[model samples]
Target: MIGDLLLAWISEAGNGTIADFRARAAWLARTENLDLHESATGRWLRDASALGHCEVDWKHGKWSVAPPVITRLPLADGLAVLVGARRQRLLRAIDEEGVYAEQARRLGSSRDIPPPCTILMPYERTRDLEEYAAALGAVYSGCAAAAIAALLGTTAPAKPTAPPAYDSPFEHLSSFSPQTWAPTLPSRPNPSEGLHREQVNGRWQHLLRREGGWYATDLSRGVFAELARRGETVIRWRPDGDHRTRTGTVIVDWGASLPPLQARALVLCSGFVPRFGSAAETSLYDNVPREIAARVASSLGQTLQTSS
Candidate 1:
């Protein structure tokens, strides 16, 4: 039960440091009779990390976990993960394949018909039907579940909720060029106007929210126009107009509910040198010319623009 609680916490938090887990465990112990200590939590994390259930940073004491991706496997391999009444049901499904063959044929190519193992793998990996479908490349659509349903002769699961336009606070920042003026924008809003403006040096300089954070801008109409042209929602202040008020605030909404990028992107974007065990294994960014990185960055910008 403690192990289950730990996994649940990791799933909800996405990532956390050892201290974070320890504190959370303590709280759970007090409120929920979860009686796990810091040492127990640490041991469980280490074991899970060793088993490839999660990634860990020993030095910094941070760990992260993602839902497992679906991989092709045979029945023997599949049964190693499935159990209980579901296991018996899967056996029945596979045994009755001949009965469903005609039904499966009407759905699509017989060759594309997923096995009982395919249906069971999702159940073994996660209880989240959407995550299961997504791992099988169905995304929010019910296509993956439909395939499994055709095989099992059951109704397909409902389609997942549509993802939001922007998911992360960092996403809007990543849209701009890494080295450009846009990437330097400030995230801290001005207390008085609730805008990205601050008194810097001796002048009241305007700041824009960009790639990494807030950056100083000239506050030119042209700059606002350019940002708007780039598909950013720019709320301009009108002191004496209908949109004006001392209490008016600018709200920046991060859209699109996509999952955060994995550690590889975090490492590369932060300029970290990743170490691999074998000399033969090399980082993708290693020995690559700066031009390649720049080209990739430009392509990302283009993709964001197109999506917007």
Candidate 2:
């Protein structure tokens, strides 16, 4: 079935569409003795999704797997070139185990370029058509093959690793040095011309009239810093009601509370009540973790002990 083929392709190739997958399943059944019927295929795919493998669909043009699979199987022996290419695009829309393996293709490819401190890829990198294509191909050809081989009962020798606590797959990501980074703040609105002007740094310093003339702080900065310090490198942003709170608290996906064990942090700024002011106040939050609760409790304990 179509779903079976897609699942096999996803399992074997990492991603595939209905037609492309069906064609491959037909070929594999006929040649490789892989008994993947349509019903069986769908069942396998459902199983794969339940087990956390991402389902990827490509709707562009017709494609063939026989030739490329044969041609690059040796030199580019590990990656899932075809599925990797298409899968990265899907990563933007679907969280799929939260890592978004397809999108991480570029970060692996551009290992030289220091990654930005944010979760989402920069607009320029994500929008670049050619770069995305290359990333897909690289991932497909590099990793997909090894994944397939492992599925087919082939085993490669394992590599050594550092200690468990010290072993972080994304340890390289933390090597970022903000000193070498150049700031690119968005342009601010001009009250004089009644339009957005080149004003920047709209943090706590910027006074807002819409906020009842209350000077606002950029809560994102504080949150980001806090999470980073706590080792939560990934975060998602959610806005709070302006009437309720000036800044929003950070939360994990699926409405989970911010974990004391920080892995990542995200900043949300929706429904913030704005106040009109002479200067802009956009630098309040930096979206990093601050460990405020622990710090506050520690200070309170010290004061109580002194008084007693």
Best by lDDT: 1
Q: Model 1, 101-165: lDDT tens per residue?
A: 11110111121211111123323432343443333332222222112222321111122222211
Model 1: residues with Cα > 4 Å off, grouped in runs: 34-38, 71-77, 80-308
RMSD of each: 20.8, 24.1
Go through the candidates in order and give each one's C-alpha lDDT. Answer: 0.32, 0.26
How do the residues 1-308 of candidate 2 rate in per-residue lDDT, one tens digit apiece?
A: 33323433454463346565545546655554544445543333322321223332222322322211111111211221122122333434334323222222112111121111111222222233234334333222222222332333101112222221212111111222221212222222322110011223321221111211222222222233333334443322223344333223332221111211121111111101111121421112112122321222222121101100
Best by TM-score: 1
Clash number for candidate 1: 15
